[model samples]
Target: MTIQVLPEQLINQIAAGEVVERPATVVKELVENSLDAGACAIEVELEAGGLNLIRVRDDGGGIARDQLALALTRHATSKISLLDDLERVASFGFRGEALPSILSVSRLALTSRREIDQHGWKVAGSGLLDDGSPQPAAHPPGTTIEVRDLFFNTPARRKFMKAEGTEFRHVDQALRRLALTRFDLRLRLSHNGRRSFELAQAEGDTARAARIAAVCGDEFLANAVTIDEQRLGLRLWGWVALPSFGRAQADLQFLYVNGRNVRDKLLAHALRRAYHDVMHSQRHPAFVLFLELDPARVDVNVHPQKTEVRFRDASVVHDFLFGAVHQLLRRIRPEPGQHHRVEFEAPAFSTPDPVQSSVPLSYGRNVSTPSWPVREASGASGSAWPLYRAGFAEPEMPAALNATEDAPLGRAIAQIRGVFVLAENRHGLVLVDAHAAHERVLYERLKLQLAADGIASQRLLLPEVIRVGGAEADQLEAQFESLRRFGLILDRAGPESITVRAVPALLIKADLAALLRTLCGGADDAESAEHFNEALDAQHRILADIACRAAIKANRRLTVPEMDALLRDMEQTPNAGQCNHGRPTWVQIDADALDRLFLRGR
Candidate 1:
């Protein structure tokens, strides 16, 4: 092929291919330009998903009449002028290719007036246009860009457009992402003459939370925990949902870096590692986090869309983000006197067999020993009955034990079928799954101990040998050291066989071959390898399995004292609201709900 300079119009259309993939892309570029222009209020109007018409008006500093034509030319921008400016760019639109590339494929009309100008000037452009003369026009002291028939000149690109509704959803998502970063600005969006949303400027923390609730959902806000941490010149603040509130997909995760939305692999991995043991395997945690640091410490020009960033010190950033989220999740204990209730429909009734019911049954003596003395009913802050009082021995009894109603999980009254614990509090009733609750408590304790002191290993009497395929063996060999950190000692018996000589004391009862196979299978890819390394390095998964094995099982009878001790432990344990499997450990039924069920005082 002969080398020749391509036409400016062709060059621009090619650039447009990179910058404008759909109507949403067009909206992103234009809105970013407006943001860089210092717009506090931006309004967007779309028709036919922006294929037919897209009008964006922003109350920002407008262009002068003399510069209206220059604005249509490629590579002209007021945001940056030097290499230093590019190194530490704070503006959203620094390349100045958005307008010209957009103009190359659409019919664009730009009208603007500076604050000092009495009237605005209008300039119109079509396909392959280098410039357009500014004509006198009457307008406000801001800018309004009207784009019509996008990709009209490029018929092939137009053919690739999706349906109107799908396109509109993309535009809506783009707007939502931008809205999260700029709570101080007002954003209004309308589609086909119907207003989609009109968000006012958010001022304080309360208002910002309200805005987040409006955008994310009310349920997310109710289940989320606030986070604020600063260290090593980095600040991360946001709300992360409780482990039980996790979603099936990661669509709800919104992360921002220095006021710009980014989708980064390092950040995602850090978050996943932080919630490794606490969350279920099939679920993803939801969060809206913002990380702030000096501009020079990060690079945002890795992609044309600017949705991925690179940190100068990735390990430090990773550690900081992981530590912040991990600490926040670790401190999520249920507050005293706090209660939550969920209502369910009444169960259907079944007729009992009269003959079976007529038979009399003999009863045995109750095993519960009520010898421990109970204090008088005090306020919410009353001291709890100590679990370790005199090494579980029964103390001298009082006449009656007054169980207060102010406890968060209430005072245990009975064990239902040796599985659920029934309690009474300020709320109507509380039911807790003893097995799941104990599993979570033990899991957290194991994690703490593992963090403080490394996992203890048990030597096997005889080494167990297993054979595997060549590919699996290669992966196992590559991650041999990482697996050893989790207390799984291995040696290469042959090319396709390995011998396990020792295992973590906690996981001694677990299936050794299955776990090794899983680790090897997951190490086939880089991302999965990193994930497995982190989990094994912390021995989190192994600890979870151990906790499950060591926890109290269902249908295991307990004394009143043991039941009370379990309740007290749950109240003090972090993240006790959900078990290792992400299922809720306990549920509350409020007094009002009980009243409604019986139609009392009607």
Candidate 2:
């Protein structure tokens, strides 16, 4: 090969290989240019998944008649004039290669009218058309860049493009990041002749949050917590949902660097670190963070799509953002109680309310007879019901550990740490965590009651008003009816807070502020009244710090009769060994494993 200068079109196609990866790439470049030009209103239209046609219009400062030609050429951006400007490039778009790269991959057209000019001029990317073509244009100053037949010349790149719907999703995601960062702008996006989204004139972050709620829905908003903090010269502000609010996939995370949307490994790692103890490894949190810093310290031209940026001090930025978010969450949302629901059998002789009666009842191996309920009538006199209720006698002989299918589970072998009750069965020995078993029992009972009619709620004597964030405020208002069912009285207090007058009696002693914050970041429909109440109850179960006190704990002694009753309760539970969090409440170790460990068997 000889050393030679490539033709203009050939050079452009080569550049397009890096810059114009897909329709979204084209949109990103053009939109950045519009934002750089200080456009308040941006309109984007695409056809055939941005293959056949793509157009971007912005009410930005347009090019003059003489400068239009030079703007099409490579390395001719008006964003910077001096070399010093490169180091201090604060604009969303600094590199001028976007226009030239896009023109290379498609049949491109740029038309603009300056504030001083009456008409706009059009330039064709395919050199076949003249530069100064007279076209019918609009009045105010703005720029319109139209691209047709994207990757028409390159079949390999076109083959990699996804389906129309999939491509549209990328476009929507990109637009969402931009819209979230720029709340004051009005953005309109349409694809395949259908208007997908339109954000009209957002006033502030509040308006912007509402718009995001509409787009991402109330589920995300309800579960999202505000993140606003500055350290080490980097400011991170946005909304992040709790770990429970996360999706199975990392689809909801949106990060912005300065004003440009970028995805850095550091950002992802920082987020993973922030959610280290809170969320499980399989789930990803829903977060939208906007990072603001001096642009001179970061290089946005590191990648062709301008998505990955290089920072002057990567460690400082990472530590600050990660630590700030992590600490805030930890301080605000301490560990909740182990589980939510609790179940207890109604006393045959007494009907004391569980919430009100805190006096411990006496228990022992000796079964006590009812004091005043000895009067019997009809055919049920002196039946086995009293023995079963008192947990003293079995109706039939106990089955062995290796019994046949027809055999029943034997008497309780032991209760470990008072929390778990162990019983011998035909095949094996079963160990059950009493709290988890009881929670399952209660959850089922409550669900049934809800399906039939509704759960009964007790109002508070004095309504307790707890302040909540704006996102949670909206969610509380949206899910008012459902929260009422959970015995929560939520009312909007201000622009960014809600007042909680009451909560589920089960969570009365909980840290109300933290619980509300935790609930705000859930993934289900917080918009629906039912979902809101579900969130409250779920939070009470998962986030309230009452489980330790209410739940049966290890080392607490249990009588033989109590152990027998606990075993029976475990048998009725659907999932006996695990809690709602998928953590094992009890483990199973067979005789064979014990024999093998002891070298008693081959």
Using TM-score as the measure, which candidate wins? 1
Model 2 pairs whose backbones collide: 222-520, 222-521, 223-520, 223-521, 223-522, 224-521, 336-543, 337-544, 340-541, 401-426
Give Cα-based local distance difference scores for all models: 0.77, 0.64
Encode model 1's per-residue lDDT on 1-602: one tens digit a residue: 89999998898998898888999999988888888888899999999999999999998999998888788778898978988887787878778788889999999999998889989999988875534468889888889999999999999999999999899999998998889988988999999999999889999887888788778876677667778899999999988877877799988899999888889999999999778767888999999999999888898889888889999999999999999997777666554223235544332244657776665433221112111111222222111343222235664432322346445676778999879998776656778888888888777666665666555667888888888777767767776676665566888888888788888665565577776665655434555454345645335665676677656777877667666666767877776778887877887776655665445555
Write one digit per residue (lDDT tens) for candidate 2, span 138-246. Answer: 6468999899988887888899999987887888777877787677788999988789889887677667668767566666765466778986778998777655455
TM-scores, all candidates, are 0.81, 0.58
Task: Provide the lowest-lDDT 10-residue window in model 2.
Answer: 366-375
> Model 2: how far is 204 from its true place, Å?
3.2
Task: Specify the poorest-scoring 10-residue window by lDDT in model 1.
Answer: 365-374
Candidate 1 TM-score versus the reference: 0.81
Q: Which candidate has the top score in lDDT?
A: 1
Candidate 2 Cα errors over 4 Å, as ranges: 127-139, 334-602
